[model samples]
Target: MARQLAVALTGAPGPAHRVTLSEVVAQASALAVSGTRTLLGISGAPGAGKSTVVEAILAELGPRAAWVPMDGFHLDNGVLEGLGRRGRKGAWDTFDVEGYVALLQRVRDLPAADAVVYAPALDRSLETAVAAAIPVPAEASLVLTEGNYLLHDAGGWEQVRPLLDQVWFLEVPEQERVRRLLGRRTQDGEALEQARAWVHDVNQVNAGLVLADAHRADLRLRLTTRGDDSAGGSGR
Candidate 1:
């Protein structure tokens, strides 16, 4: 099996092995054949391109891999509103961590012969969680889960780390991250200043927590750009 790296060997930097997105996907695809089911985690601060990596991986290994986002377990908006946490919706406390862990356990315990297990997905457009929107078929050997807190240790978040076969932390420049985050906040009709303010007050606080523990990841990948549909760039 070949190793996937983010550096290319020839073109730009000497002694560096720059790899393409396809290279990484190929290596991840190879993991499905490793006997046991593989749970590969991609963790990073918000706006660090975690979802992009998952999208790229899923596109590369459809059916063989399924995405189980931590965002799907986000607490309902009304619940947050009731608790006065509506202003900071993406905080770790705003999510149902136990529920996510349970779903992950099911993904591990159930075999390919069993009926597909349904998983919820976050409807960011509606700012709500939609239940049982994605099904994990019996044949999927790779479960790709991403979020801001897979590596987070507070309030039982540490328990999340041991369940995965591998984990990678995504890195994006702070300025670029802030830019991307502001773009997202504005997508929902926030004014430019409002977006920046929320990012500084809300998003950065959470990002601080994520960055503090990035070194604990199995691999640290600094992406060249945010590679999702709403964003694009050359990735390292």
Candidate 2:
């Protein structure tokens, strides 16, 4: 695992003391073996690779860890349309912030050895949330949840941070993050112009909200693509 993380960080430009992916994994591993259910959050603006980092850590940790993304708490498209928020689908108000906080509280309080907690999942293709789609079992000591609003402090979202044991915020260059958002929208079958419009009009607005409370995160990770620098540290 260390070798894989080392290779992933190799050739990335950053300070000599940059925290490696291995260290991140180590932190997660420590939580998993702590003999208690731990919830670790990964947060970032849209396109900041929150899912990518969470998936990598889960892959390394294997069966001891489980994923519970906050995307599952997104309000149904119908609900959004009824609320007249369909045009700004990814905004913080588009999510069921109260429901998400309730789930986090349940996950944090319930003993992993007692029962299975079913979490909802987001069907990106359909852009709707599916209930009871993800099962967090008895043995999964570390629950990793990633999303854009874990650090957000308003609109009923301020309750989320206290439930998490640790949170890592991903920091990607704005240009790169915007590029990824555009690519994702286009890949989801939007026309180029439509994708551009959505990225600028909808996603970027939400991104601003997520980035505002980033300082509350326990760790801040600067993840970059090939030819870019990788850097991160505790509260940096």
Candidate 3:
């Protein structure tokens, strides 16, 4: 796995730096299946398309992989309301970070003995996390987990980084990312203007926090939509 820093940012972005998804699949395959169960973490700001990338990897690898989304660790809406944080539900503190860490450790340790280790998954339509909704089978070589906070350093999130065998951060152009987020909000029943407001005021701020920690990633993935929607990444 590699991290990409634009040549302009580090000096001249490497022309030979172009990468494809096959390389990413090969890299992830090499990491986890080579031996013990490995956790592959994916981090990105909202709308950076972490889910899309994770799905692509699973599609490429098939049954050799399993998935656990950090979004599944979101505290209940009632808990958020009790904490007076309901208005900003996607914020880092809104999640059950402790529970999430514990689950990851269990996923790594127990899958070999347990027929399957169950993990929670968040349902956006219900706006809640359903417990034990996903299963990690014993045969899975790599477990892929994605969220907005894997590399985020503050608020006990540092615990997450150490648990993952490798972490990749997704990057997309800011304006386009924001657009995708707004579209998502619209699908959730928000009006166009309301969606835009939410992205600009809330989502983008969280995105900045996530991006700040992108340097911690083993890989920096650039998913360009400008052309054939090809994916590429670089090593740190």
**CA-lDDT, candidates in order:** 0.77, 0.78, 0.78
Clashing pairs in 1: 6-19, 7-17, 7-18, 7-19, 8-17, 8-18, 112-138
Rank by lDDT, descending? 2, 3, 1
lDDT of 1: 0.77
What value does the lDDT take at residue 52 in candidate 3? 77
- Badly placed stretches (over 4 Å) of model 1 are 1-19, 225-236
lDDT of prediction 3:
0.78
Best candidate per TM-score, number?
1
lDDT of 3 by residue, 97-163 (tens): 9999998888778646548888999988899999999888888989999999998888989899999
For residues 1-236, what per-residue lDDT tens digits would candidate 1 score against the true structure?
13434222112222212234555577677777787788999888988778777888998888889888899999998999999999998888999999998898888887768668888999978979999998887788898899989988888787888888787777776777887888777777999998889999999999998888886777666544234322343211
Query: How many steric overlaps are in each model, in order?
Result: 7, 0, 8
Candidate 1 least-lDDT 10 residues: 8-17
Give the per-residue lDDT digits (tens) of candidate 2, residues 1-236. 43433344343423222345656677678778888888899898888777777777899989889888899999998999999999998788999888888888877777646687889999987888999998887688999999999988889988999999787777777777887888787777889999999888998888888888777777666653333564222111
The best-first sequence of candidates by TM-score reads 1, 2, 3
